[model samples]
Target chain A: MKPPVISAFEPPRRILMGPGPSDVYPQVLSAQAKPTVGHLDPLFIGMMDELKQLLQYAFQTRNEMTLAVSAPGSAGMETCFVNLLQPGDTVVVCRNGVFGERMRQNVERCGGQAVLVDNAWGEPVDPQKVEETLKTNPQARFLAFVHAETSTGALSDAATLCALARKYGCLSIVDAVTSLGGVELKVDEWGIDAIYSGSQKCLSCVPGLSPVSFSPAAVERIKQRTRPVQSWFLDQSLVMAYWGGGAKRSYHHTAPVNALYALHESLRVLAQEGLEQSWQRHQEMHQLLKQGLQALGLQFVVAEPYRLPQLNSIYIPSGVDDATVRQQLLRQYNLEIGAGLGDLAGKAWRIGLMGYGARRENIALCIKALEEVLA
Target chain B: MKPPVISAFEPPRRILMGPGPSDVYPQVLSAQAKPTVGHLDPLFIGMMDELKQLLQYAFQTRNEMTLAVSAPGSAGMETCFVNLLQPGDTVVVCRNGVFGERMRQNVERCGGQAVLVDNAWGEPVDPQKVEETLKTNPQARFLAFVHAETSTGALSDAATLCALARKYGCLSIVDAVTSLGGVELKVDEWGIDAIYSGSQKCLSCVPGLSPVSFSPAAVERIKQRTRPVQSWFLDQSLVMAYWGGGAKRSYHHTAPVNALYALHESLRVLAQEGLEQSWQRHQEMHQLLKQGLQALGLQFVVAEPYRLPQLNSIYIPSGVDDATVRQQLLRQYNLEIGAGLGDLAGKAWRIGLMGYGARRENIALCIKALEEVLA
Candidate 1:
């Protein structure tokens, strides 16, 4: 067979201000393209140590168990749920949008009961409602919620929720997939037990790696698991051996070396820019985007205080067609923005100002493109 | 915080003849380092479509549901088992090595009962035993086994196994992780239902992705699933949305774009080399390595006819310490060979000849190194 002649992969020059992945830095991309070192190589082990440190900084935790799960954000979610919860465990899941609902599904699949705290589609989880649910369901083992809900651009108060979980004697598993570098996630300060984040979101790395951290308490729970983690791949203890220190490491699945290189470079960039600066950059650009959308008579679906600055869920203009606008952006502007998901479908558009894409130029460009399309 | 400085990632030149991730091609590494585009970008969707087609060609199947799962080989195993087997489902699993035991665990985790057919650690799974197990457990929904047992460097007869599964009205879920590009796999011709392969093994891509294909029957099983797949990340139906056709792709988790780039390029290189040529290269190199090892008085752990040419499991030389030999190989020769796994540990050394690592030069070098160390 003639080698399937591929048209040279000439990626369009677009500012990726979508849900994810935000535009990766040139240095990070170059890092990804680097020669792959052996996963168990001594130099690679050093790199892993650096990566674990970077992840700890990004997640704002001193937890020694911080590492990148070798999969996407959803698999990161799976890693946390599968490792911590077991058959007959009761988890209080906050469902305001798509990711929260995903948590509910994960809980049920783990043979755990989900005591759902329902909220409106684009609204943040109400802590009072969660407290009431947790109090009523005293058996709840964990309080699971997305810190920055990607689908709806809603930001729940993670610290408050974690405190509530502690008050109820439940561990807190936070999903910071969208909030890792873009928002304030004080994992240690908040007393979060387990938290998972994505590389592609605010980190602006490539898409396959997910940075996860487990507090010592969460690690203790995993150590005390009655059942052998059902999924061999996501088992925390086995994974720790590969990522752990020492001359002799236990063998696990092959590590994604190149992806880790990219992630390491990305986290390096984050450290250089300063986490607070990155968060400020996201917020400022989001403000610029909000002003531009307002100039076009568009309104945000999420209320002011609770909305995630990185992901702005704005209502589609009355005369504008959602798919057509996205099509025009792709065809003419060569820009990619996300459409609203689930209940928000057709009614909203998710304009993301995340990481590298969280810039004045991208916001300005998106506004100009939207104006042309809406015209 | 000080910028997370990495001591420039310098990959030392090494001949990786181990179970996996065998030396990745320069082009594949470069591809992985490419700039990450958005997962849902038009350019990316085009790539995803191309990837699906490439996977179809690699698996030798016209199954529409062919794509890379965004995790390592173990997750690929979980995806197949969790999707195909529901609660109370009966599965006949053949356990000759570590990966086979993993399959049995997956079956049990999915609430499926596994009828295990056990064989010696360093031997191919006996088809007659599998047939007997299936006959005894006639209600088996699927027959699960490893095509390439990495732990033992043994290759089971996939064609015969699939035929037996068909005879018993059971679907076949084959672990082709180490066999896909290094050897021959005919998913359609052999009547396999679901198959999973790792990119790191012979595909010579980075480790994050698992290329998988599901036959129409397997797809049907998933569609008619009585209970939701226990894994939210590995759920095929939801995955299909992101990987599926034309203008209307579903919002799955963010893709690992750069890693997929590496996989697509690796597959492209495989196509360029011709699959038959790649398999031949592995075999020829294996022949050279086998002759050299035999000359050095090393004994093979597996029977010649049933051995996987890519992965050669040899008994550790008498009184030649396993740890010392492997460490010396790594430190001195910069060569990384695998230590024996599971029950075979301390007794065997698995030297691999796979993908870019499979060359007469590497074989000659490995033999020379082993001779010097053993002497």
Candidate 2:
């Protein structure tokens, strides 16, 4: 093969309305372009400490183990499972959508048994069913579930699930990938034992880092694990030495310095707009978008009470091709909306009003684009 | 705790002479600040294809399984191990410095037995010793070694070791993190089965992306794995579907869009400069820096032949505290040099001349700063 004669990649400025990788705040983008520094630099270490605190505020947790995973949300998800699950451990995994099934896969991959509590494609996870399963599986050590399923725009009750997990003597692990900054999530108050979310979602940061937190109980479980975490990279204990407090931080792997800068800026923006206010913005935007989509004669996949404000999944109208409309929106209007994943694929469309992307202007533009495309 | 009242982190420009995260090119930095786009966008996918080809050029490989890992170099290293090794597999590992030990750790984490060939730190891997180990361990399926030992500033005999591995009927996996662009690396020509590299090293890109390539033989081994790969995120097969060719791509995870743009820019710069020219330039800059360093009566860590042009380690001058001198350089001159790691910690200083940082100007400034600090 010959060498590629490629010029610099100049990506089109897309209005990202997809489930994730939502529109990055301009300051966050600029933060990434800031001059490079050593990962162990004093100022950088200071930035990391502040990043931990900011992540704590976002997760609403006082867990000292709160820090961003160097990889995406999947790796973050792996970090929770690998550290918490020893071989033969039983986990009550709630399978509501794509991410929950992913957790089941992770559980099995780690040699842990997953007793799945299944939910419909566009439905919230039932805590009553989860409690019954936990009661039956007396060996269950963890209750793993998605707080917000990006695939079907379903929002499960995290607080109720965590309470159920605690009642059954199981630690809770949450996949808050699309839920953290978009909805009402209180990790500490809700008694969440472990949690992971993506930077690309409601935080509107660059798409790499995964902001994860482990409670004292989760940390205790990790410390008492019989087998080492299968992944050295995703191993939380090793990562803690680097992200752990104090001026002297050991080198685990080089921290993605610039990406953290972007995260800090994004989280700073989140802090400036208080968490409650951000959630309200997403709710308001979802209401506006919902009204507009209804006017366009589209039907919602998820029930109104269980729907996520950030991610909205709507049924594909009869005779409208999935590829054609998404392609048109991409090429003609430079807009992106998620195609339904898993069972919802080809049948529904997922429109996001996530952080930085959640706004009146974006909603208006998306509605107009969809209306014209359908016409 | 009160929320962090931190402002946007405006990193002060420092002339980076640190091992890895060497000065990122200005264009690469600007590339990162470019507009956000969907990971599955046609434009972004096109860029991903170009990125694979560019990486192939960088590694001198035509391997179809070439793509960047979403995390840093450690994850890239883990990617190579977790995919290729199954439980009960024995790998003949060369232990010379920190990275080689890391290779052993990864193999053990994957439940594989590591048969180590010992070599002195700052010394290249002895091909004869590696060959002997390969012969003795009939169960050894893989030969793993670092091409360039970043911690010890030693450049090993990758071509010869790979040739030995091929002769011994073992697939070769190389740590090319520091060797990829600053030194000569021919993945295809050398018959290397697998290799993992860091974007931050010689490429001078933003950190967090690891460019990894696997030979057909290696991919074949992964395909025929007895058990599912422990870490789902690092599984090559799943990642391949997304980074693989054509219009119909599966979403494994969100690609770090802006980081890829920066890497593309960095690779474009490398391609424009040409690989051989980059090596020669690194050598030329190393010579310039060496003259000044030798004049100050500093002793090189690695002997003449094994010394890496991109990374230079020198013994700390007698009576000078390691932290004080490095801190003085940072605070006074706005220069950043690496502190020693592992066995070499507090005993030596590692100065880098990699990628954009490999220049006469940086060398001059580094030399002037060192002189003042020493005085």
Candidate 3:
């Protein structure tokens, strides 16, 4: 079998207003391409320490266990689950979107039972329903939900959810994949026990690394697990040995050196701009985008109060073919907006104003492009 | 909590001769820095198709299940195990070095029993011992071994081992993490049911992606499993839908778009160089390095017949501080060599000539640096 004669892939410079893989910060991309270094090099280890400090700030937690998982957000999600949920344990899982359903899958795969608190695709997880489920399932060891549901552009109330988990004596595991840099999340103040996020989302890095943080209580649970974590690669404890602040770090798996380099630069970019200010920018951009989308006659799937500012899920108009509009946007404008997933598939299109992608120019271009394409 | 005021990381260009993350090709690094794209973008999907085809060429197989795992080599190892090994299933695992032991760990974590076929750290798997073990453990459903022991510079007979597995009616799982592009490997011809390799190794790509291939038999085994794969993230069946050749790739997880770009470019580089030529280059470089090291009074860890050309593990001369020499080489010369792992720790040093790192200049620099540091 011969490899076909294929040319180098030169991706078009896209205006990415999609659910994620939002336009990367130029510095982050260039950082990854700078040079390759040995993962265990003293200088590289110094960089890893800085990376941990940055992750702690981004997650807003002083938890010593904060580090980026070497894989994507999905693996980060799995990391939290496999480390926390022992077999035969029950979890009160809130399912408002695709990520929530994924959480349920992680639970089942971990041999834990998922008692789902179902909500509409476009709505936030109802705290009352979650509390009721928690009351009913006293055996539940964990409460898991998505902070920002990228699938349907719904922003669930993570603070209230964490409080509910605390009240029920359950560890709070939050999926902050799309929420971290774009929303006001105080992991320490809110008492999030275990949290995971994506680099490509609000961090504006390439779509690979997942920044994750674990509170002391979450670490305690993991340490006390009788059975070993099923997936060795995603085992948080083993991973921590390499990413920890200590100088004498043991060899675990080979750290993804270049990806971590990119993450470091992206976090640096976020820090320079300030986290709250970044969140504010997303909100401001979202308001502008919302007005344009409204004037263009596209109805938003998520309600105003429950909406995620970074991810705006709008209805595909009555006659719009889902594929045609997305394809046209890609080919004609060199733009990319996400087609819907799960229940919202074919009915909604998600426009993102995430991290570095949250700019007035991007919003204006997106509106102009949509208006022209629709016309 | 605020992110520390850290300046941008500028990695020094070192000549990497480490056991695994050998010097990455500059084009591969620049390729990753290319503009970001949506995971489901038509152009990105086309690139993924090309990537799979190139992987097939590298592995010398026509397996439809050929694709890159989104994480590093460790996750790739887990993917092969969790998908194929069911609970209570038995596997005859040959442990020649660090990776083989990891295979045993994977088998155990998957709720399967691993029958050990232990070999010395610096030697290849003894086929006679493996056959005897298989004969004794008739219930052994799988045979797993490391094709190239990166830790000890031993290249096992994968073809002979795979043949033995076939004769015993057991599926063969090979860890080619260090062998892929630097040595001879034939997936279809050897009847290997499953294999995984790292990008950072001989492929000269950055250290995250792991290219994996599964024969029809392995795929069939996964489909027939009664127990769910322990990892939702590493589940090969679910992952296949995203990387499969079908035009409509369902969203399993957001593909690492930029990392895939790097992988495609690296694999393209391999294809253009021709697989056999790349292997021969590593062999030639190894002979040159051996001559230089022998002249420098260094001793090879593995015997000539069983040695791996890409990874050369040599004894650290007694009375020399292991850390001082390595540190000196790194600080003074900007050259990276590997510290021995596991059993060989403090006794051996692994110098790699892998993929893009297998050049005359690297060998020369490595020898000169070692001489200066040792003196």
Candidate 4:
């Protein structure tokens, strides 16, 4: 068979207001286009060291085990689960949305038992239920939850949950994929044992790498594990040898060199804006969008306090077809918004106010596009 | 403590001739800087469909399961292992070099037994030995081996291996990380059940994506598996829903959108050049490099017939210090070549002529630089 003649792909310009891959900063995208370099080059290694420090700042933690996992956020979540939990171990996993259910899947696949603490789709994980589950399954080694559930736009109280886990002598594994930069998350202050986040969501970087950090206690648990990590690619112990501090680095899989360049630039942008200021920008944009959405008679699926500012889930207006509205918005306005996932599918639309996407212009564009599509 | 200040990262330009991540084409790099789009966008999904077709052309297969795994080659290797093999199943793994050893690790981690067919470090897997092993271990469900061992610069007989696997009623899982575009690999004709390759190597794209293909037989095995795949992220069964045919793509994970752009551009370049021409160019460059290295008293580690054209592993002179010579080459000439791995460490240097790096000029420059550094 003759090889298909594929021409150069030129992707269309998009106003990304979706759950992730929120419009990457031009500077970050250019960083990705920079000349490729050997992963083990001394200059590259020096940059890697700086990248770790920058990641530390973005994660709001000075944990020594901070580095970007070479894969996506989902792999980062697996890294935390695979490294900490061994076979026959039990974890109290709080399931509130899509990501939380994914956490349960990880637990079961790792040969560990997941004692699920369930909550409503658009509600924060019930702290009372978590406490009761932990009290009952006292042998549980970890308490896992998603801080900001992207699917439902619900933000759980990570601080209270971590405190509960600590009180119950269980390590906390937090999924901060959607919360890393758009929201306020102090990994150190909140005492998150292990946390994984996406570079695309709130970091305004290209989608590929996952920034992960481990508290010292979490590192200790990994060191104390009797069995080897199930997934070698996501194994922190081996990966650390490559990303670890020193002049000498071991050969793990080739670090995604160009992607790291983009991550560094994105994190540098985050540092310049300051974490608190970035959080404020997301919240401010969310308020602007929320007001516009409310004017259109759209009700938010997640309650006000529990809602994630970065990801706003709103009910699809009556008489509006979900796919039709989304398609029309894309075709006419070149704008994109996320459709609801899981149980909320077809019932809601998720409008994101993430890092670089959190601008007054984007808020206006999204609202105006929705209005036109609805009409 | 305040966040450490990180300035913009400017990577130094160098001619990459390493074992992998060879010189990426300028067009491919520019493609990576393209505007980021939503992973699930209709336009982006259209690009993904074209990408699958391009991958099919590169792999020389008509399998509909061809797609790019979001992570690097190691994850791709894991994807093949975790999806096909179950607990207590037996796999005949050919261990000749570093990647072969990695395959054993994957097998063991998946709760499967790996029966080893060991060969010398710089030699290809002996087909006779493999047949003996498979015949004795009749219960073995799979035959796993690396087609091109990056560590040793040895090219195994993939056609023979695949045939033997079929003769024994076992599926074949081939690692073509370093072989794909640089060598003659007819996935359909050779009857390879499953195969994985890296974008960084012969494809001349940036690192962080793995192009994989599965024959109908391998897909059948995945579908018939009694247990859920161990990894949620690397599970091909779940990932197929997103990368499979049609317009509506399920949200599995946020793909590396810009990186996929790079891969598409690289694959287009490959198709334009044609696979046979790419293979011939690698071989011709290898011949040029061979003459120059022979004059410098360098001996190849692998035998003439078994040696990979793209990755040429040569022994260091008895009196020369490996690190000093490589460092001098880097510092003085701005060139990157690979150090030996595993058993060949400190004794061999892997000079790659992969993809865009396979040029008469690159071969000439590498030879001249080595001569100057040695003097």
Model 4 Cα shift for residue B13 (angstroms): 1.2
Question: Each model's DockQ?
Answer: 0.55, 0.78, 0.85, 0.84
TM-scores computed on chain B for all candidates: 0.97, 0.99, 0.99, 0.99
**Candidate 3 clashing pairs?**
none
Grade the docking of candidate 3: high
| Residue A40 miss distance in model 4 (angstroms) | 0.6
Write the residue-wise lDDT of candidate 2 on B1-375 in tens digits.
Answer: 345687888889988899978899999999999998988888888888888889999999889999999999999999999999999899999999999999999999999999999999889999998988888888899999999999999999999999999998899999999998998889988999999999998999988999999999999999898899998999989998899946789999888888899999999999888899999999999999999999999999999999999999999999999999999999998899999998999999999998999999999999999999999
Model 4 lDDT per residue over A1-375, tens place: 577887778888999998988989999999999999999999999999999989998888889999999999999999899999999999999999999999999999999999999999999999999999999988998999999999999999999999999999999999999999988899999999999999999999999999999999999999998988999888888999999946799899988899999999999999899998999999999999999999988899999988899999999987889999998888888899999999999999999889999999999999888877787
lDDT score for candidate 2 against the true structure: 0.93
- Regions more than 4 Å wrong, model 2: none
Clashing pairs in 1: A32-B33, A33-B33, A208-B256, B17-B352
Clash pairs, model 2 backbone: none
lDDT of 3 by residue, B131-173 (tens): 9999999999999999999989999999999999999999999
Report interface Cα RMSD per prediction: 2.3, 1.3, 0.9, 0.9
TM-score of each: 0.96, 0.99, 0.99, 0.99
Candidate 4 residues lying further than 4 Å off, grouped into runs, are none
Task: Name the lDDT value of residue A42 in candidate 4.
Answer: 93
Off by over 4 Å in 1: A1-5, B1-8
Per-candidate clashes, comma-separated: 4, 0, 0, 0
Q: Please tell me which model should have the higher lDDT, number 1 or number 3.
A: 3
